[model samples]
Each structure stands twice: as C-alpha cells, then as structure tokens.
Target: MMGLRGINRIVIAVRNLEAAKKLYADMLGATFHDAHWTGAPFGIHVSIAWDAGIELCAPMPGREHDSAVSQFLAHKGEGIVTVFFGVDDADVAVSRAISAGYACFHSLDYSQDEMDQHLGGRFCRYQESYVSSADRCGFGVALARIDRKPG
Candidate 1:
C-alpha cells in the first residue's frame, strides 16, 4: 500500500460481546452490524459500527489458551487490538508487511451478518495487523485502506 488511511476499525478484545455491544450500541450511539460465530475457537464476533465498525471478538468463554488475542488482553489490557486496511491485494499487502517486519493477522473467512443487522445496510471488509513494541504504548495497530459502503 502506497498511502495508508486513518484508523478505520477499533477492534475491542472483550470477554463479553453482548455487554460490549450493548454499551457501544445503546449508550455510545454505535450502530451494530450483526453477530457471527467465527467458527474459530472464539465464541461470537459482533460487528458494531459507530463512526466505524469495530469488531468485538471474544474467546469462547473458558477453554483459555495462549493465543494472540489472549496475549493482547493480558498485555494491553483490552481496547483496540488490530487495525485493518483494505488494500489492492491482500497477498501483496501481506508481502509488504512481511518485508516491513509487521506481523499480519490473516483475513477472516467472511461475514455478511453485518448487512443483516444494520438498518441502513452498511457493509465492509476489514484486514489488519499488529506491530509489537514494548516501549511505544505497549503495542501499535495500523489500519490501511478501509473499503466500505460498497461500490
């Protein structure tokens, strides 16, 4: 990616997806997309779009493992984990990230739940990465191009 975009999505690593969704959607004026069972060991993923769609991905509750998301909560103490970017080629973008020494979080299978949940019918595809640096605010998340609202 030549020019990177602003912070597109703020992924919150929370234990309670429903609680997070309630707070964000009801109190914080966040318009939620839809929830999905990621098929990962994790329980459910709720896509909440306020100004941006922040994916609230939580572990399946119990059956804890030394996974990256687990480490994220252990280290950063919840909030924003990964930053997504919509690039021309995910493979090429991933290659560039590899060259830049950035750890890439591979693409999610596919979720159309968001469109089904939202009243306005907004949709988007998110790709992200996490760069570790103990000194710089614990860690840093960067989002590239956020392709949304469809063509």
Candidate 2:
C-alpha cells in the first residue's frame, strides 16, 4: 500500500491573486510571501502561505484559456481546485492511483539542485503528479514528494 504522508497543500483557483490573498489573510490570518511566483508553463501566478497550507493561483494576463486553473475558475467560479497529498514517492502514489481507476494527467520531477536554483536555494527536490478527480470526487488530486535537506 502506498500511503500518503498527509495533506501538503490546498490549491485555490481565483480570478485575482491579490484579492484572494487578502481574503485569506483577513479571514484565516494566512500570510503569504511578498514574492509571487509565476508558473509560466501553466500560464498562472502562484502564491503560497506555507503556515496555512494554502496556495492561491490565477491565470496570467492574456493566457486565460491556456491553463487548467483558468478553465476551473471559469467553470466552477473561484474555489478549491486541488488537494495535494504528500507521499513518500510520487511515482508509486501515481501508480497506485492509476491502478485504482484514477487518471493521471500531468507529472513533474525536479532535482534538489534544480529547485534550489529556482527558489534561490530554499526548496527541496520535488516530484508530483496530477490526477483527475472532479468528475467523481468534486476536486482534483495531486501526489507530491518533497525531499528536504536535513538540518
């Protein structure tokens, strides 16, 4: 059995990242970093509140139709988009999900060095796979494995 470690983060798709961040801050006391990261390939801007385990995502200007986040916001109207599960191994988790009749749609693997460069030496090695779930379970699921450097 490939057991998940825990809920890593809850991704919320929003029309405006700043507005969503403010809402979360006022309602839940969540504090996000000043630097907003862009997932250019996905055509979205991402902001995360690590302590709150919430991630806000919004479509980039002029690329509204190019990503899943935009499509989700358009269809469902700003809401929880994905629940990311922390796993020991993303590949195994994805395989288990597939065996369980779930469809895996996308995957990403990043080495520690790569992530370090991308995050200014703050992130760990990461692997993730996005699985389809909305049709049956109301929201999408994602399996992720993050190997953090030991203290």
Candidate 3:
C-alpha cells in the first residue's frame, strides 16, 4: 500500500533517446539514473529532484513504432508521455483515486537502486488529464499518483 506524498519525478517518453538525453542533459541540467536503464521499460534516463522525470523510452526490438511510446511519438511527435507521481501508499492511493473516478495506468514494485535509482521512489500513473507544455489533452496523461517510499 502506497500513499501520496508529493511529486518526486515525471517520465516523458521520447522517440530519440540520444537527442532527448542531450536536450535534457545540456538544456535542462538533468542527469541520468545510470547508463544501464536507457532502453528498458521499467527504467528511466533522467532523474530530477523535485520536478518532472523526462524519460526518452526507446522502442526497443519488437516494440518499434507500434508501442505506447511509439503511439505517443506518432501523435505528439516526441515528448512526455508518462508522468510518475511520488506517493506513499500506492495501492491505497490507487484504490482511493479509482473510487474517486480516476483510472489506473499501472503499478510498480522495485528497488530504486536496483532499477530506476531516483531516491528509490516507487510510483504509479492515472489517466487523469494534464496540460503538457503542448496543451495536447487540455490535460494529457494528467497527474501521476505516487509515493515517496525509498526504493
């Protein structure tokens, strides 16, 4: 069971990993979790302290141009697709949010150090609406309900 604490990070799935990496690293002054989780689904590339986590998730192997990331790329043409909220009790939050009418995207349970590595924070996302800098959904993939639990 996880609970909402505050925002820890956000994941922006991109089509080009290197391009997004250089853009965020040089332009946004962000850093990667490690060099290992670049192309992995359950891993991220950038880790922000108190802001959004922009993940340029690559369409690796059989997942080329036809996956969630790819769909985001095709529709929005490369940018933030998923937002991970930093919460406390994930299960509890999801249950509460669903009861309140929010749809669950998914849930994750892994050691931050062993995987995503941003203070070991585990998180989840809701289909709530959020206005990206692009104003795609008037609220695109809204708020990422998360927990600040140490991974």
Comparing 2 and 3 on lDDT, the stronger one: 2
Model 3 residue runs over 4 Å out of place are: 1-3, 34-52, 111-151
Q: Estimate candidate 1's alpha-carbon lDDT, on a 0 to 1 scale.
A: 0.56
Question: Candidate 3, 135: how far from true, in Å?
Answer: 13
Best candidate, TM-score: 2
lDDT of each: 0.56, 0.82, 0.50
- Cα lDDT of model 1 by residue, 15-47, tens digit: 676787788877768767655533254443556
Runs in model 1 deviating more than 4 A are 39-44, 64-68, 86-92, 103-105, 108-137, 140-146, 149-151
Candidate 3 residue 110 C-alpha distance from true site, Å: 1.5
Ranking by TM-score: 2, 1, 3
TM-score per model over all chains: 0.62, 0.87, 0.60
For 16-97, candidate 2 gives per-residue lDDT tens digits of 8899999999999998863344376788888888779898888888888877587787778999999999999787899899
Candidate 3 achieves a global lDDT of 0.50
Q: Global lDDT for candidate 2?
A: 0.82
Alpha-carbon shift of residue 110 in model 2 (angstroms): 1.0
Quick one: best lDDT, which candidate? 2
